[model samples]
Target: MATPRPARAARVLLPALVAAALLGGCSTTVTGTAAPDPAPRPTEGVGADPVAWGDQVCGALLSYYQPLSARPDYAGADLPGIKDRLSGYLGNVRTGIDTGKQQLADAGASPVSGGDQFRTSIEDLLNRTGTTIDEARADVDQADPNDVPGFQERLQAAEEKLRTIGAAEGLDQLGATPRLDKAIAEAPRCGELDALTAPS
Candidate 1:
């Protein structure tokens, strides 16, 4: 071991070092920082931002409805603004689901069960959000977005499902927190219907 220190060949070493330098910027090269976004990473794509959308919708709902809650007769006053915002946000998220579908395809993946979970959950969200928008619009059109307990229940369920999907990576790995979170939000929303309004 002491006799053989091994020879350093600059001939081999220079080319290896040059090769590393060359490949560093090569198309086929990989780096620790960038593993490549096999599927485009974006909110409307794989990084669906439904939870943020829900939170915004909730904030809007709470802003409009809470005041209306105290004065049911004046509920129609808050209709136009809430309806416009809700419709726009829901429309945007619907587009997001469509974008996500394309992303899955681009990633060389098919519509699997996990994708179904995300799809179904988002579709449910779209429906419920649409219902809220309708309820809000009904306030402007026929009536007001007043004490509609049933609509609230649907909205809350949609919110919960969105949260679950947001917290979990996807459907297949929807673990305890996601499920429990959904349960917690959903149960209370459903129960509120019984005591609040009979509008179903």
Candidate 2:
């Protein structure tokens, strides 16, 4: 008996189609165009744009210092009143620490040489201040109206701590970093920061 024509064609065409499909599956799709290269990261020694970095740093600092800018006066308040104001003040400082940490992190690594060290020191300072503030708040919470002298003393101590808790230290750090100092001086946002913290 003669081989069926359709069967013979199927044997021939099936393998060819399978092979073509397999090859197509293995082939990569082409767009006839090359993709753009990614941007290069700054090298270890290389710094970021000084003015831009300064702007970021100053902006972050400003936000960090905002909560403490205007302190609540507890001048004539009695023990309970004083405690309330003091607690509120310490709470603001705590909030400032939280705000500042986020801002600093958002500011990212310093672009100038030795900037990282300055950033680290500032962060450490903030952390320490936060711990101190927490302790002060606890003291305020536990203060006894019966012990007038002790309560006043604690309040005085907390006020002293607040006086030292503002943005001067961060400015001093900037001064230590000469390049950053210059950059910050040139940064417009830093100018706003200066005005905000300036003696009124």
Best by TM-score: 2
In order, the Cα lDDT scores of the candidates are: 0.31, 0.53
Write one digit per residue (lDDT tens) for candidate 1, span 129-174: 4444344334323323454554344344433333322111233343
Candidate 2 wrong stretches, greater than 4 Å: 1-48, 157-179, 196-200
Q: Per-residue alpha-carbon lDDT of model 2 for 158-199, expressed as tens digits?
A: 544444443223434332344555565677766766665443
Shift of residue 3 alpha carbon in model 2, Å: 94
| C-alpha TM-scores of all predictions | 0.27, 0.60
Index of the highest-lDDT prediction: 2
Q: What global local distance difference test value does model 1 have?
A: 0.31
**Which portions of model 1 miss their true places by more than 4 Å?**
1-77, 109-144, 148-154, 167-200
lDDT of 1 at 41: 27
